[model samples]
Target: MNNSNTAFELTIVVPVFNEEDNLERVKQEFDSYLSKSPYRSKVLFVNDGSSDNSQMFIESICKSSNKYSYLQLSNNMGLSAALKAGIDYANTEFVGYIDSDLQTTPFDFDLLMEYRHDYALVTGVRQNRKDSFVKNMSSKIANGFRRYMTKDTAEDTGCPLKIMKTDYAKKIPFFTGMHRFIPALIMLQDGKIKQVPVQHFPRIAGEAKYHLFNRMIGPFKDCFAYRWMKKRYINYEIINQG
Candidate 1:
């Protein structure tokens, strides 16, 4: 474990996949956030084998700022894999996650941070989403179905902004769509979750990764998988240890 006094209390993982155009703005946004963050925080960019120049930009940004570091995957394993890799590498007390597209602001992390001590996970619920009709509606349908299946009670599980205790996050079982079920996974461990309203924006650069089909169908299937895992998840506490 990293010494709390010396290392950052939180590390925000920014998972990147062909986000070349968004890298510069991402650096500026996170840099500004760190300057004003209440908790000592740093950014960790996880490159999921971006085929574009995204890795170059990530390297440049990391070199220019000590607040930034990164992990590069050998191939594109998708968001869940990248997130799991980031959480596995994180050594801070708390770990945060945000998209590189900047749909959710890094500034709102303050709101989530305020409740970090009270819950295992603090996730954002985007208020007044600025996405297309299809995207928004599909997400709503998916979220509703997911809530019914998992009973996680998360209003907006698709929200990209979230803060999680490193211990709980590291314990989450990783799956193909694990990123979409963070709150549910935390709940499976008997941990609490808090959701706060946050700002949302339209994509400034690069393309949206998921479309209606994947957004809806992928989550629909994964919800069942979560149900299967929930039934068998094991939890135990040790009373004595040598």
Candidate 2:
């Protein structure tokens, strides 16, 4: 049975895809963070149709504490859909995101929470990333191109560690490459975003799903799609409502 007594103020969505090797540590680290979090927080693991034992691990974790819950997709819909599912299902004032690979620590959420009130989205910029040369180079090229095209001014939109008001997150329009345009989409809603430096570590388990094509070439093409959409996006304000 779930701990019905726990009060949840924030939902940290962890999207998992064949990450059975790291779920044990994920449970430990997240549990530690929840124990001392300033806000009453819960972890929601979205299993993106993993063929491994990830689903079993997630189920076990959720059963261990009411602080944890999960959503299992029918098939692998990629990160964008998995994240959108989690965001839509989240019933908290704020929603948080972190990768399951353990490169980014759940503890950095405290750093983001520091500015959560002032900014619509608070994202972490990994300092001294522990990725390979090709991965780093591709990310730089992709991020630079995205900035030039979208003009979102986000230092590291690719950084997986982030927190945003659940309302703004839910308002974001969804698409195939939607994950790459989160900060830009938030900006479309006239939302404020703050990026802060955070620790980055080398991945100890599970293989990275991205490659040169998806990381660099794919985002390069998505920039044009984003530009096209940006011109057509609509927003409004109601000063007088009875």
- Could you say which candidate leads in lDDT? 1
Measured with C-alpha atoms, the lDDT of residue 10 in candidate 2 is 80
Cα misplacement distance, residue 102 of candidate 1 (Å): 0.3
- Tens digits of per-residue lDDT, candidate 2, 122-175, equal 999999999999999999999999999999999899999999999899989888
Model 1, range 108-158, lDDT digits (tens) per residue? 999999999999999999999999999999999999999999999999998
RMSD of 2: 1.8
TM agreement with the true structure for every prediction? 0.97, 0.96
- Backbone clash pairs for candidate 2 read none
Best by TM-score: 1
What's the distance in Å from true for residue 236, model 2?
Answer: 2.4
For model 1, the stretches where C-alpha displacement exceeds 4 angstroms are 1-5
Q: What's the lDDT of the predicted structure labeled candidate 1? A: 0.92
